[model samples]
Target: MQLEQILRERKEDKDILLMTHIVLGYPSFEANREIIRQMVENGVDCIEMQIPFSEPMADGPVILKANQDSLAAGTTVEQCLEFGAEMAATYDIPFLFMTYYNIIFKYGEEQFFARAKAAGIKGFIVPDVPPEMGTTFLKEAEKTDIAPILIYAPTSTPERMTHLDSIAQGFIYCVARRGVTGKKSEFGEGFNDYLALCRKSTRLPIAVGFGIQDKDDIKALTGRADIAVIGSQTIRLVDEHGPDAVGPFIAGLR
Candidate 1:
């Protein structure tokens, strides 16, 4: 099934989808494989395999540290892709890539898309690449059947939302708050209204991320969002309690 279709079906079944994010080769490539296996067994609907970049501007301290550590461990882009391919081949759910625009640019856009598709990447979550500047990248992704997910911030204008939704496929990543990832998100007033606006702006599935920590946060998104994305907190959990804690923590979310 298509990525969006799978997400929509989950929503229809009244199941709140959980999308987990992990930095590929964070602790190590081998450990990442186990972490992903556990996440899947624990009820992760989708997995965002982040290719560690030198500067992940949209991420907070936790992810930043993971990126640094992964890079320091000599985690290359090729290794990430190989890992993604292995996971995609092994798993039944969607596997997406989360990385910076520079990584794709340096790796060659066409080459990147082609290789990612061949590696079993269903889509991409490029935090740094905006729709306006990512024309060629979007076109190439379309040709390769790779969905290019777009993000919308709380501060985004209606015009911006409409523009982004026009190009976004697979899902619209609704950034829970205005800042970077990691901090706890206090869902303020009009949260439902904001999600409604996003739904009106796009036909794609809406997955909210950033600052999503506990089961309470996941429950809070109940009918408002189609998918709940937990990133920094997952990494923090693994860092504090080892990979075994991953499945239990994700299980709690469900």
Candidate 2:
């Protein structure tokens, strides 16, 4: 099924789908596998797995450390794909790999798309690759039936937003704040206003991320976006208390 269809099903229930991010081999491959299992068992509507890279520019310290640790542990792109394939075979959920464009370029877009599609990955979010530079990969993705999800921030200009909305396939990742991918201060002023503007600009599902800590934040976002993506908070929970914490933390979200 398409990513939009999965999101639309969630919307029909009047519930915001939760899409959480994880880094494969963060603590260890075993820990990563358990975490993926925990997330699936915890009612996560979708999952975004990060392929560890040496330089994760958009991520904050916590995720950066996780990536570093995973890389130091000798995690490779091929191993990340293998892990994802395992999870995909075991669970029936939409999975998107979030990574920078450099990795794809390095691995060769054709090879990367082929491996990811074979592994049951439905989509991807390349934050650093703007729409202008994404055409080549987008074409490759379309051929392989892989959705290329786009990211739009609160500070995006009208032209940029419109352009992104036009090209976005799976869902538009609405960055809740103007800064990096992590918890933020206050969700910033005029947050909902920005969400409303994004809603007006695109028919695609919009999943808001960054600084989504408590149920109140999720409540505040009701009817504003199709999904609430809680990354750093959930990742922090896993880092602090291990994979078992996913159930309780997700219960808190509900």
TM-score of each: 0.97, 0.96
Q: Which candidate has the highest lDDT of all?
A: 1
Report lDDT (CA) for all predictions: 0.90, 0.85
lDDT of residue 158 for candidate 2: 73
lDDT of 2 by residue, 17-88 (tens): 888899888888888788778777877888999999889998888889889989998999999999889888
- Candidate 1 TM-score, true structure as reference: 0.97
- List candidate 1 stretches off by more than 4 Å: none
RMSD of each candidate relative to the true structure = 1.0, 1.3
Worst window of 10 by summed lDDT in candidate 2: 180-189
Candidate 1 lDDT tens digits, 1-254: 66788777766766689999999898988889889999999888899999999999999999999999999999999988888889999988899999999999999999999999898888999988888788999999889988889998888888899989888889999998878999998887766677778878988889999999999999899778889999999899889999999988988886
What is the clash tally of candidate 2? 0
